[model samples]
Target: MLYKFFVKYLKPYKKIVFIAPIFMLTEVIVDLFQPFLIQQIIDKGLGAGNINYVIRIGFFMCILSLIGILAGLSTIYLSSKISQNFGGYLREDTFKKIMSLSFKNLDHQSPSNLIIRLTNDVTQVQNLILMSFRILVRAPLLLVGSFFMAFFTAKSLSPIIVILVIVITVVLYIIVHKSTPFFTNSQKALDRLNTVLNENFTGIRAVKAFVREDYEINKFDKKNENLYSSSTKASLATALIMPFLMLCVNFGIVASLYFGGQFVIGGTLAVGQIVAFINYLLQILVSLLISGMLLMNVSRAIVSVKRIIEIHDMQPDITYKTETVDNIKGDVTFDHVYFKYSDNDEYILKDINFDAKAGETVGIIGLTGSGKSTLADLIPRLYDTTKGKVLIDNKDVKEYSEKSLRSQISIVLQKAILFAGKLNTNIRYGNQSASDIEVEEAAETAQAKEFIDKFPEKYEKFISQKGSNLSGGQRQRVSIARGLVGEPKILILDDSTSALDAKSEALVKEALANEHKDTTTFIIAQKISSIKTADKILVIDAGKLISIGTHEELLKSSELYKEIYESQLGKEA
Candidate 1:
């Protein structure tokens, strides 16, 4: 897994990776000489009563230590520089993949999971790269060098070093194997916690209104606690391996002292040779312990790399790479369009056919769940039709690039969404280069200028998050003004005026009619009065177009339309 991830992301930094190993090897060489210098001082100077030999070896040892420190610093700097750059590239690529993913692909992953992959998982891989250079490369070098140095002095101490290495390796492998699955589970728990917390914060007003604060709080705490427990369990299991390996190291050193002491007292081993063997044995033991620690860090990093790979391997369902079209006409047609969200379920839109010319106002009225909004959504390709063609300007909508198709259409939803910015900035969102006069004109046409002018700063006043500080009708008007600023050829109002009073609704409607006389408008509304004056009205019922005519024609012929008209107008048809 580590090799695959490196091939994908780290291949570009081949120079840095290649140079880092040279510095690491030099550092290891410097470290291997320290113990040999100590032996020389002990045997030649202390044993023979020669202070000159001790001083020379001691001074040379200090010089080697300084070179080792410099090499270690160079190794760390190069390794970290490569890791940081690689992490940045990984993060950007992951986020770009998420952005290109369609709704179908995105449904399988949560926002928190994506965030974890981008942040926590990326950090894990970065640390691994740094550690592989700093410690992993040194462990094997020290182990092999120490063994060779010890063999030249006395081969009897070699058995103890070999056994200690085997024991530490087995223990480290067991800990890594057992803890990997638990760490994966801990990451998933964190995703669930993020989802619950996001939902609660977004619906905080509704929760408080219904007096369910305690319920929401309890639910969030449960998920949060689950995450904490999983993390603790994973951490405890991984932490136990280090101390256990340290114990093995300590035992090997003690065993070497008892066995090597006999060889020193006998005529077989000299004092210098015994001293050198002890130093080599300690070096080998220390290297084994360091290898165990490096293994643990690398094991955890492998889990994160696999998690990030899941996202990178995903293919977006919607792929459109055609050239952008700048010239667009607003003629739209739906030919026998049938659509369903699932293969097993009934169609959301069935055998629908309609045409809206370049300049017309088409009103769509329907009962709840009648697929009114779904029909309008087809024009912008929000969801693909199960079986039909939606055409614009005599060309299939799918043939156009996504940018060009969306640029020609604008929609204002029932629930207004406003970002935290000045009122002018919100109104000018559809067209950023719109001047102050054009912004004020659009707001006035939407009947938003009245409430907006009441504020001291007027257009410069700041809106809160999602426009929570504004009333429902006020937010609706601002959203309308935003859509209108673009001057789109195809404008869709999906229940855009439900919150307005009779007077303000009529005023906004009149403004739209006069200002945008040539733009094609598709209005999805619940109120009969909102659609009565349109050039034509479409009555949809249960995913089918039940009736299509003007309001008066529908009142005279269609019973369902007449019924809705009477219910709202409060009179007999």
Candidate 2:
């Protein structure tokens, strides 16, 4: 599965991948030639008292070293370029896939986990690719070449090389096998740490307000400790590989030198040949150590690849049609709608049925978790109903393309979210081509113009992330202005005005009535006063619609509506 992902993402950079390994091989070949030249200098040039010959061979050896340096530099540049570009493309595609998922799909995963996957996990895979193209390709080739050269130099030394190789291989295999699971656990711990940190920062205001700083600190400490523990265990396992490799290589060198001295004394082995043989043995030792380090990286990359592929394999629950509609009349209907978050969960909305005509105001009132926001979400098709259907313009919403359908409906969520940009930029987010006059008009209708003009830069005033610089009411007003700038036909406000003062809410309502009388509106509010003046009122309780009438009619007919009105208004029925 991991191989398939690499193959798919790396298809575009095949040329770089192919060329980088060739350069690595060239460097390895130059390194292999060095000891042979040194042997010739010692046995033939120096032994025969030929000083000029020694100089000639030494000069050629310097040229080979320079060529090896050039090849190594070229390989490093190409491998880094391929890894970074591949990681960039993968990150972009993964983010796009996350954005395309439905609300239900997004709810299954936390934002922090997704962020970690895009950043830390992608970085792991990129580093692995770089090492594979550079050290990983060269290590095995050097190992094989060194063994052949050592045996050809002296047949008696072949047994020592084979014994050391077998012992070191066994030790490396054990270290990597034991460390693989720890690496996987460490990655998971890192995800948990990110989740805790994200939640702490996002709700820092609440933590300070409630005087729970110590509690939050303790929570973060616990998560941080877990991450540290897991990472240390994995690191310690990898650390053992290097020391064991050095021990085996040094022992092999000692054993060869002692045995080669005995052979030289017996007049059978040349001193120059033993010197060349020891160099070849050291090369093999270095290559094995590099291969061991690459193995550790490979294990971590495997875990990261699996996590990334899990996201890529998910199929979005909602699919769109290609059909386009020239105009939408802003009429919406819910026919026997039933919904639940998942199949195993109990239904949150049951048998809901309602219709609102163009230019009509429909107010929805419900207790917390009574499906007010869920009903508003259906109009935009944020989540499909488990049963029944939603219709717009007398056609099933599923018939229209997602872009065509959502473009006509504007929704202001309960949470007023704003990005870091100028006030004008956020407002223009609703309609990118909105003119300056239209921007002012929308802000006026939403009651945001007064405070906006108070700032020195007016519409160009910069807003911080999540509008931290603004008050609750100011942020709500800006969000409303953003929604109105598009001039959408169907506007759904989900308790968006709760932060506004009574006077401000009244002005916003009046502007909507006067300036956008043709647009259909759905107002979901907890306060009875906010929605009492709508053309029709729908009362919901425990996922069931108990009454549908005007304020006066509902007061006379429904006990729940009468009780709520009396509680808020303190009036007798």
Q: How far does residue 424 in candidate 1 sit from its true spot (Å)?
A: 3.6
What's the true lDDT of residue 304 in model 2?
A: 91
Clash totals, every prediction: 0, 0
The TM-score values for the models, in the order shown, are: 0.92, 0.98
- Collision pairs in model 1: none
What lDDT tens digits, residue by residue, belong to model 1 across residues 76-152? 99999988988899889889988888766787787777887899888988898888888888889988998888887
**Whole-model Cα lDDT of every candidate shown, in order:** 0.85, 0.91
Error of 2 at 430 (Å): 1.2
Best by lDDT: 2
Give the residue spans of candidate 2 off by over 4 A.
Answer: 323-326, 570-573
lDDT of 2 by residue, 37-67 (tens): 8888888998888999999999999999999
